[model samples]
Target: MRQDRKSLAWSTLLEIDSQPEGPLHRKLCGALRSAVVAGRVTPGSALPPSRVLAEDLGCSRWVITEAYAQLIAEGYLEARSGSATRVRATAAVPNQGQPRSNPQISVPVEFEMLPGMPDLRTFPRKRWADAVREVTASIASADLGYPDVFGHPRLRERLAAYLVRGRGAAVSADDVIVCDGTLDGVVRLCRALRSAGHTHVAVEDPGWSRLSSAVSTVGLTPVPVEVDRDGLRIDRLRANTLTRAVIVAPAHQFPTGTVLTPARRAELLHWAREVDGLVMEDDYDAEFRYDRRPIGTVQGMDSARVVLMGSLSKTLSPALRIGWVVAPPRWAEALREAAVAVTPPPVIDQLAFAAFLDAGWYDGHIRASRLRYRSRRDLLLKEMASTLPDLEISGAAAGFHLLLHLNDCDAAQAVRRAARLGLRLVDLDQYRMSARTGPPALVLGYGNLSDASVPEAVRRLAEAVRGKGTGTSCG
Candidate 1:
């Protein structure tokens, strides 16, 4: 009986009640709270009646009531005079979310060079607190009815202005849809495309792997298209007759950091026009270009053909969980309908974000983070040159991460050695679907390290690569 109850709770909270030296009431409360938070019991989902749950757990009725009361006090459960107890709506885990294969599973966290994570330690907590307080006090009570089915109007207006000025996107408040993050935005668009009869979509060959779930979750096939020096291969894109859409990380392609060349951008526009297939452009980190001025966004070339995804996750913090999709006129309604079907982020958080952007606090925070991260990137590059010279580098133009190719070396073995040394690093070959792989490369991220620890981290990595100095080059 306890095992059955434990299984049910795991489906909701991913945590089982610990075997404790406590009374039955405490254990029962822990199990139920864990179950609700794990999403086993969704918002508005009701709980078993107190008596029914008591009978199932083989506990007294009063014991179950007290347990339910504890959950209610903790804000994880709710109760009414006659209605069954229900789960309260609350954020369960941390870091916006992960690939989300199991919404119930706790987000996976280990070496985390999986890509695009911001240095969250640098989040402007003081500024955020001020903004949150201001919004919480100022927002009218009636605004809490439900999320603006289309997203917060104030955020839309602010995001449109920011995108046009900063990212070169063509959008109006009406054209923007707020979402949890890029992956959520993708899920929304993919669902809309499916509704419109789009079955197969193209994704870049060593693209964001999360797309496997985000795109397929909505029942569309993610067709793999190769990306080379120019960007997404136009030849293959043009050749595919069945392609109905495409997803591209054009700003600084994930893991590789290659910006899309101008010619390719034009070619992409031409293809979108000719094929009538929309391009969902993820223009992340366009604000932090170190070498060249960040190029104008692909969405600006033809707003009718491109859907733009931009987020505060890298610019601010992933914990903010605020992102927007600037859709073409055709996709606006479809995206909103899909969002309504799932959990839209809390209204209060959205309002706070809108206020933050409106007050110009968002821009101030971005500029500070950009300067700090740029310094980290430059130091990491210098350290790599001084400490590990044989490594070939690419995708270093922008973003928090850059890839270093170990010349003709055993990438897998090097990664294992680095792991053994407590130095975390990610391999690039795993990003590819085909067996034809790139050189032995490590995707190193720098934004999280303190100034003093940068060199020490590189020093340890160097030792790992040498295998204590056998120094065999992979070339």
Candidate 2:
């Protein structure tokens, strides 16, 4: 039985010897031929030079040369001119997920304005790195062992303090459960709600698709209530036969970027109260508002019903991988219970973040980032108006994203063309929970781009909308 190439390659290779009774070269060639036949030398592999093989075997180079010649004649090796002997081409190998040689070419324009990405360059690296090193040094080895299921206590404390001032949310460190991000925090909330007898959750129709996914991830059906400029229609909650929770982006609605009006906020609170339900407020980008005063959170007014979630992913960097779930006092224990054994945010990051806040670096960065994003946003709007004056944009007053309504245009087609041209923007319809029966649109994020990148990116985007190619990733 012939050995396999992989196995034979590992052991002693057969070689011709002295003290030959029959021709040693012939015997060596026979062994080499068998090894090659047994898949030893893999096709197209170069044989060791005769001299090297002869030295190893302590035999004449002729012996090794003759042996290699046998394999070459037996179709195991291809000795082509100007090419090292290589394994013959075979059918596709067993390797999976092998990337094709062809890849998308680099371009100067990108069409996809991907949401949820922060301007990472603005991260206070020196401060954050110093904080990380400090926290890593200060925290005990036990702290590194496993996170306290819910989250780091110090981080929760800092977050509670920060949110109380920034968003008017009343939360103690104990009421906070640190999770991976807003999505995971919402998922944790949904699991808790479902565990407590909820079967359905109300979400804004044309809502953030993620809200629906978060609701559904825990086995509950998503009851997508309608959303208008005022936000989710609270009046329709009673009509929802199964809803016990509502997920909302009150500060700046996703894709639309409209603040939930004060009147609507009150109304929704009333609806949640009436049904003995809950409101999951995703404060996605409330920190970067440019319009009216920062949108006051509904949680500050009524903490018991609102599971307010927020993350620094936009304010700082998502790579830090920290988010908070400020739950009602009643749910804290269970939320922590769920968190205790789950994937907690890394302790070092949490500690580093706590120290970062302690150092007052995050605030400074936020101030700088706010100015930068505002400039980029203004440039985007300016360039869009100059290039495509007829195009409509909404959600401009605040938030990092703008909903671009290319009137009577094909949003997906434009997105595809832009992607081919190397743009990294998303079509507005892509974020919709249900089919958008209205004007086709795209989502433009200006938060990450620089002032210079903004105008050119949007102009190229406008070009893409005009059926011209724009293939660079925006920013």
* TM-scores for all predictions: 0.76, 0.75
The prediction achieving the highest lDDT against the true structure is 1
Candidate 1 is scored at a TM of: 0.76
Question: Using TM-score as the measure, which candidate wins?
Answer: 1
Candidate 1 — worst ten consecutive residues by lDDT sum? 1-10
**What lDDT does model 2 reach?**
0.70
Candidate 1: Cα lDDT at 378: 85
Q: What is the model-wide C-alpha lDDT for candidate 1? A: 0.72
- Residues 1-475, candidate 2, lDDT per residue (tens digit)? 3223334332266533322456777778666655555554544455554565567667886565444443443334433322233333331223234455422333545433677677766677788889988887788878978578777778888988988887888888878888777867776776678678988888777766645644543556777677777877777766876787888888888877777888898988888888888888989788878765676789998998888998877888777668888888767666766664357778898899888888888778877877777777887788888888887778847767888877777777777666656777777766565455566878887666666666667766776788854443221
